[model samples]
Target: MMEELEKLMEEAASLAGIYSQEWTNRNPSDPGMTILENLSALHLVQRESAAQVTEHARISLLKLAGFVPLEPENARLAVELAQKGPFSFPRHQKFYVNNVCFETEEEVRAMQGRLLGVYVKGQDEFREIKELKEGVPMNARPFGSEPLTGDEVYFLFDELPCGRKVGVQLYAEVKTSGTRNPFSEEEPVDFARMRWSCLTSCGYEDIVCQDETHGFLQSGKIILWIDTDRLVKEQVGARKGYMLCCRIVETAYDRAPELVAVHGPLFSLIQRDTQSFSMSFGGREDIRIQPVFPEENFFFVYVREQGCGDYIRYAEHAGPGSEEVQGRYYEKRLMEDGRLQICFLDRQRRYLPAEEENAVIVICCNREMMLHREMGVLGGWENQKFDLPPGGCADAKVLCIGVRYAKAEGSTCCTFFRPGTEKRDGVFYTYEEDSGQICIHDAGPYTGCNIFLSDYALSVWDAGNIRFGNVLTSAGGNAGVRVRNPVRGRKGRAKESFQDIRKRFLQDMMQPVLAVTEKDYKELALQTPGLCIRKVSAYFEEKRNQICVAVMAGTEAAFPRLPLLYRRQIERYLDKRKILTAKVSIKDPTYIRVDVYVTVSVIDREKWDIKKVRQEIAEELDDRRNEREIGQIISFDSLSGRIRACPGTGHILELKTIPAGVPGRFIRPGTDIPIPPDAACYPGDIVIREE
Candidate 1:
C-alpha cells in the first residue's frame, strides 16, 4: 500500500494542487504534507478491516466471548413403527444408548417378538392380546360325527425353501353328523370357546410366524412380514379342499418418518398422526451470520433438561452413522446430520397411571446462536429490524423441540425496503440464500421448550408371557391337530455397504486355490464373495460315491439359515470345480456348539491374563470368524497353540470339551475329533481356571 501510494504521489508530481503537495512530498516535516499522514491513518483502519474479513471467511476461526460459533448437530433417520391393539406405552424402554438400531439381524418370529397396539374404544382402552406365537399348529380334532376304523395321518415337508411366506394346502374330511365308535383310539373332548374358525381361515388373522395360516383364509391373498434373515424349506398337507401354497412375499411397500435424533427417557409428545418433523439449527446456515463458507460445518449434538441449565448432558441413541468408521470393525460409517432429536418409549406391561395430557417433552441443546459474518452484512435493512418466527409448542398440543429465530420486519432479499410483503415467514424459515445459509422450513412449535426430536417409536414390553399364537385351547379330544413342517423364514441378506463390498472383494482375491479337498473347499467358500458363513466342510460318501458339502450360512451376528438359492449357487460352484464323474452335493450344514472346559497350571496367575486367555480360546474355537471354518476338524493342537500364544502362558495343565446336544465324556487332549460331516463347531460355554 505504501509503495502504491508512493507511485501515485510520483505520478501526481505532474499535476499540481489537484493532487495535493502532501502526497507528492516524501518529507513529513513539509507543511503541506497531510496526504502521507492521512494515508498512514487509513492503513490502520484498512488493516483491521482486512483482519476481520479473514476471520469471517472461516467459521472455525470465528469466536465470541460467551457465544460458540457452531451449534451441535443431531443425527436423523427415517424409521418405521407398527402396532396392533390398544395398549399403554412403557413407563421406560430399555434402549442401548450408544447405538439405537437392532444389532442382531436374526429374524424375529411371532413367538420371538410381540407388538403392542392401540385402538379407540368408547372412552376406554383395553389390552386384550396376551401372546402371538409363530409356527404351524401341531394338533387337531376330526371335525365330524364318525364311526370309522383304520384312519391314518401323514405329514410331509417340502425340500425347497420359500423367501418368507409359504402357501399351505390343507386336506381334511368333515362330516355333518356321526354314529358312535370307541372314543379310546381318538378321544372325544370339547372346550367352551369352540371357534374352529381360527383354523378355517388365516387370512384376517396375523398368522403366527407368517406361516400356513394365510391358506386358512380361503379368500383374498394376505401378506405376512418375515423378520428372519432367510428361510430353509416348509411344506404342509392340503387341508379343507383348498390347496394352500404357503409362499412368502419378499418385499413390502411402507413409509418412514425422518429420524431427528436417538435419545430416550420418559418424555411425551402430541405426535403427528402419519408424519413427524425435525428442526435442525446447525446444518442450515443463517444469512444474518456473515462469513459462512459455501459448505456447512459439523457439530456433535448434546442434550440437557430444559430447566436445568447446569445439569449433566445426555447422549442420544444413534443408529450407525455414515461419516466415519467405528469400533473394532471400522467398516461402518455415519453421515453428519444437524437437527434436534427426541426419542420416546413405546410400551409398558406394568401399567402406569400417568395421563397423556399432562406429559411434556422438555429438551435443550448447547445452542451456539450465530449472528456475525465478514464479506457481506446480513439484514442490510437501514433503520429497520426483522424478528424471527415463534417455534415449539403449537396450540399447546404439539411437542416442540428446537431453536426458533425471530421474524424479519423488512425486505430480506433486497437492500431497499419492499412494500407490504409482510413478515410472512419465520426468522429461521427465511434466508438470504446467496449468502452461505440456506433456509429449510418453518421453525417447529415450542413444545413448551424448543428442541429436536426422535423419529421413531420403540415397542418395548415383557418377553416371557408371549408363548403361542391365537389358539389357547387345551390339546386332545377326539381330534388330532394337523401340523405343517416347521420351516422358518428370514429377513434375507441386506445389500452390502460400499466398505463391506470393497473389503469382501479384496478378501476374495486373497484366496489362491480351488475346492477339491475339505480344507480347499472351506478356504474357497470363505473367500468367495457374499458367502462367508461360520464354517464350510466337504466329505465323501463312498456309498453314493459323491462329495457332500455344507456351509454355515450367514454373518457373524447370528447363524443364518441358508436359502435354497444360495445353497444352489454353492453347489454350482463346487460342481464346476469338482473332478469329472464325481458328483457333488452342497447343502446347509447344521451346527454343534462345543463347550470347552480347561484348568491350566500357570507358574504365576498374574503373568497370565485370564481375559486374554479366554479371548484367544474363543478366537481359535469360535467357528464364526478367525479360527473355525465351516466343516474343519476341532483340533486340540490349535487350541493349545492359541493358549500358548497368550502373553502370559508359562505352561498348561488340562483342557477338554463337551460336545453340544451330546451327553458323553470329555475328549482328552491330543484327540483329532473332526466335526460332524454336516456340522460346524461353535464355541459354547467356557469354564477356564488357573491351577
Candidate 2:
C-alpha cells in the first residue's frame, strides 16, 4: 500500500514538473504545486471500495472479551492411541488432516477401538469387534419418594468431564412379594408412568425426559454441561440448592414405593425454599480444597445428637446465643494451610465447641454446581511410592511422565530445570509462538510405567495452576507430570489481539461502561469462554426481579445445548453485579426446526463426490448465520450459491429450495434465511436432493 502511494506521488510530481516548465512557475507557493501536494495527501488518506471492505473485514468484532479464534493446529505424529486388545496395522483409528494420515487418541477403560483382543500369543490374531457404545455409570444414587416435593442431594464430582454425554442411571425399587412385600424375584419398576426431574443449568433445561423400563435399573444418557468457573463461584439455582438435583413423583402409585439407588439427571426436580437433608456432607470444617479440586469447597449444615445445631459459615437457622444475641451467626477464617475454617457461636457467643466429633452434616453446596476439573495434586498426594501431586502432573491434557514446575520468585526467565539434574533442562523464551505443539508418546520410565516423550524435551510450563514449588517424584527427581499423548492443544484464547485493540477503542466511542441491560448481557454471554452465541434474548421479569434469558449457540440443524458449566458462568456473572432487585434465570430457547432442501448441477461428475458436495453446501449455509438479522428465513439463492461452490456443481439445472411455500415470500432462489429470536440449525437439519 505504501509503495503504491509513493508511486502515485512520483507520478503527481512528474506531472507538476511538466506543468511548471510550461507555466514558468516552479516555486513551492505555486497554486499547481499546492494542488498536487493536497491531492497526494487525499489519495494517501482515502481508501477505494475493495480496500474499504478489506479494512472493515479485518476489524474483527468477534474477538472481544478475550475471544481468540481457534485455528486447526497440527500435532507431530507419535504413537497412536490404541484400544486395549490386538493392535494391528491399517488401524481404523486413522484420520487425515492436510492429506496426512494420523492416528486418533482415546481415553482409557474404553471398549470402542480399532481392534479386539485375545490373551494367548500362540494363535494371536487381531479381529474387529462390535462397538460397545454402552456407558458405565461413574456415579449412582438412591432416593425415597418421601421427599416427593423435589428432594436434593450434593456429592463431589471432582472428575466429571464437562460437555460429554454421561450415563444417568435412575431406578425406583418396586416392591415384590409373596405377601409381606418380600422380593422373591426381580420386577421392573415402570418409570414410564413416573415423573422425575433434576435441576440442570443453562441449555440443559431443554432435555426432554425419555421414559425407560425398569430392568435392573432405569437409566438414560445426556450431555452434561458444567460451567467450570461459575459452578465454583455461585450457587446452582435460586435457593442456593444442590449443584445437581433430582425429583421424582409416582403417578404410577398413589402410595410411595420402595426407592432404589439409581443415578440420573431429572428436570422439574426443583426444591422448594428449604435446606437439604438427604445429601450428607463430606467436607470437613476446614474448607481445604485440593489443588486440582479447589473448586470443591462446600457449605454444609452440621447437627449433633446433643443439640448442637452449628452450621458451616452460614447459619441461617441457628438459635440465639448465650447473651441473647439474635439471628444465627457463624465465623470463617483462613488457616495457614489455606483451608477455610468454620465455627458457630456457642452459648457464650464464642465460636465453636472446643472439640468436634460425631457431626451429622448435610451438604447443600452448588458448583455453578463443581464445573472445573484439572490435573493437580491437591495439598497432599495420598501415600503411594510417588509423592507427586496432581500439580506434579506434567501435561494436564494427557497422562505423561515429567513433573510439574513453577519459576522461582522474581524470575523473568522460564527455566525447565529437571530435578536432580546438573543442568537446567532448558529455558523457553517464546510461549506464544511455541507451546501446545509439544507432545509425548512413549519413553523409558524408572517406575516401569510406560511414558510418552515428546521432542519438547522440557521448556515452557503453564504456571496458571502451579503454586508453591516444583512437584517432586517419589524418587525425588523432577516433579513434573508428563502425558502419554497430547489431550489438548491451544485453548481458544479469551483475550483480544493487538490489532483488535483499535477496534475496541473505536467501539468504546459508541458504548462505554458495562451496565445491567440486554445489550451488556448479550455481549457478556458471547464473551464467555467455551461459548458461541448466535443470539441472546434477555427478558426482564420486573415483578420477580429476574432476567429470563434464551440463547442460540449457532445455526445448525438442531440447537447445540449449552453446557451447565457455561450456563453457570453467565448466571454468576449476572448475579455478581446485577441490581439488588434483579435475579437472573437462564432458559433454553424454543427451537423452530426448519429443514433446507437444495438442488445442484454436477460440474465435474467424475471428480465430484455428490454426497460430500451436498455436505459442503449444508455447512456453508449454516456458516452464513447472523443472529442479529432477526426474522430471517431460509434463502433459496443462498443455498444455490453454496451448491455452486461445490467441486462438482455445474450451473443450476433446476433449483428447488423447499419449504418455499411458507407464508412469507421472503426467500428467493437462495439469498438469506430469516429466523426468529434464539433459534438455531444443526448439521442434519439440511436436506439435499440433486437433479
Candidate 3:
C-alpha cells in the first residue's frame, strides 16, 4: 500500500512540475503550484492507494504530500471513529491535537472524530465534526451536522512570502449538544476545544494558543492579520525605521507627478525661501512625496526623529535676490558630518550663526518627512536669508593683477597677489632672436589701478612671469623704484660714453618701473588674491593675419617656426596696460637661423592713419638703420610704391608706395609725407615716395 501511495504521490508531483512550467511560460511573473492543486492531487493519491496501502503507508503517503499526521490525542479519536463510525461529543467537550493534516473531506472527518472522542446514534451520530478540508476548516455547523474543520479555515497566510504580511478571517460554527436547562443545566460547560495545535504543515510557525479559553469563545475561527513591518522592526531595531522612512520618501518623490510639472515654479519658490528653506516645492507638498526629486535625487536631507534629536542638512543656492534686490544673499550650509550650523546676517552680510545657539542644526540636513513641517515647509528652517557675501558670486566683477616670469627654456610660473585675483606671472620665455628681450625698467607710481583679465586673455601670460606691483606697493600706494649698476663699470672714453648712454636709458626706464611696498604686501595677503595666472606652453600652432605661429608645443608640428606663443603672451601683457603693438621674433632651434620676424601693431585705427603711419614708421627705421653699420638694404618698387628694404646692416625698412600717374613711382629718403586730404592708408602698411 505504501508503495502504491508513493507511486501516486510521485505522479502528482511530476504533474505539478509540468503545470508550473506551463504557467511560467504563460506568465513569468507568477508561476507556481497553488494550494488547491496540491490538495486535489493529494486526494487523488489517497483514493487510489487506500486499498493497497497500510496505515503506516497511508500516513507516509500523506506526509509525502506535505501533510503532518494527527497527534496521539487526535489519533486515538480517529481510531475510535474508524471502529464505531462518525460520533458526536457532549456539549463543552474539547481536546488538543498535534501534527494534524487534512487534504480531503474524508481526511477532515477522520481527523475531526479523532480529536473530539464522542459518538452519537443514527443521523445525529456526527456532532460538531470540525470538517478539515484542504488544510482548513469548512462547514463548521451544529452537532450532528458537518463539523467545522481545517478545510473551512483556509490558511490564507501561507500564500504570502516568508516575511510578508497578510490578513486572515476565521469562521466557527458553535452549537450546544443538549437543550438548555436554565439553572438545572450543569455549570455552563464550554463544549468547544479551548486549545488548538498550530499546524506547521501549512508553512507557518507553530502558534499554540495558550489562551485557548478565549479562542474557543471566539469560535475556532480567529482572524490573524500579519505584516512584516513589526517583524522587521523586532529583528533589527530603530535603524530600520530610518531606512523605511527613506524608502517612503523615495516612493513619494517617484510617484508625485504634479510637483514635476511645476518644477520652475517650485525652484523659484525655493530660491525665494533661501534662508531657512533650502528647497521649496512651490506651494504644494506634492514634491515631498516624490522619491526622484527629493529623497532619491537630492543627496542630503534634514532628518529629525521624534524623541531622539538627530537631523541631516545640505547646501542650497546662495546668490542675489531677483533683479529687484541688490544686496548679497546667503544660504545655510548642510554638511554630511554631524554638525548643526546656521548661516545668518550680521550687519547685512552673510555669516554662520554660532553652534551653541542652535543644537538642532543637523536637523536641517535631513531630506526626510521627519524634517518637514505640517505647514508644508521643506528643508532647513533654521538657516536665515541675508544680503550677499562680501566677495560676491563667482561671476562677480573682479580685478586681477600680478607679475609673470618666463624662463630661457620656455617654461613659466605664476602666483596670486591677493584674493579675488588670478595668477599672471612665471611664464616660459623662448627667445626668437639672439638678443634678449627688453624688460621694463620703470612704470612710475602705482595708482589705485586694479588689473583684470578674461580666462582666454590669461592663457597668453601663463607662459611667462608678468609682475604687477611688488611686495611694498601691491595693495594700495605708489610703485617703488630700485636701480642696479651697469653690467660692467665705466672704462675707456668710448666705454664711459656707452656707460653714460646706458645709465640715461636705464634712468628713463626706471621712471616706469613699479615698486613694491611692505604695506601693499600685507594688505594683499589679507584681501583675496588678485587675478589668477597659469603657466602654459605653446602646444600647437595658430593662425593670426594669415601667419602661422607656433602657439603650442607638441609633437604635431604645425604653423611657422616663430615662437608665436611667447609673442602672444607679451601682447596680452601689454594689452592689459592698454599698450597695443610690440616687436616679436623667433630664433631657430640652434639660435643660428632667424625663423621669422614679427611686428605686433597695436593701433586703435580710429586714432591713426595707415599711410601716414607707415611713413612715420619708415623714418624711425631709417634712423635706427643709420646707427648700425652692418645693416643691408634691399628695395622693391611697385605701383603702390610700397618699398621693402633689408639693410645688410641688420635692419629691415618697409615703405608704403603712394599711387601716381606712372606705374613705378619714385621713392624719396628723409621726406615727411603729409597726410593726404583724404587719408586712405591702412595701419601696418609701408608708404614711400620717389628718391
lDDT of 1 at 608: 73
**Residues 444-554 of candidate 2: C-alpha lDDT, one tens digit per residue:** 121222211211111112222121112211100111211122111222222344465666666766552354786666555544432335566666667776677776544
Give lDDT tens digits, candidate 3, residues 241-312. 100100010110100111000000000000000001122222112212111111222222222222322222
* Ranking of candidates on lDDT, top first: 2, 1, 3
Using TM-score, give the best candidate's number.
2
- The segments of candidate 2 whose C-alpha lies over 4 angstroms from its true place after superposition are 1-513, 526-548, 552-587, 620-638, 653-662, 682-691
Clashes of 2: 68
Off by over 4 Å in 1: 1-535, 573-581, 605-608, 645-649, 660-666, 670-672
Judged by lDDT, which candidate is best? 2
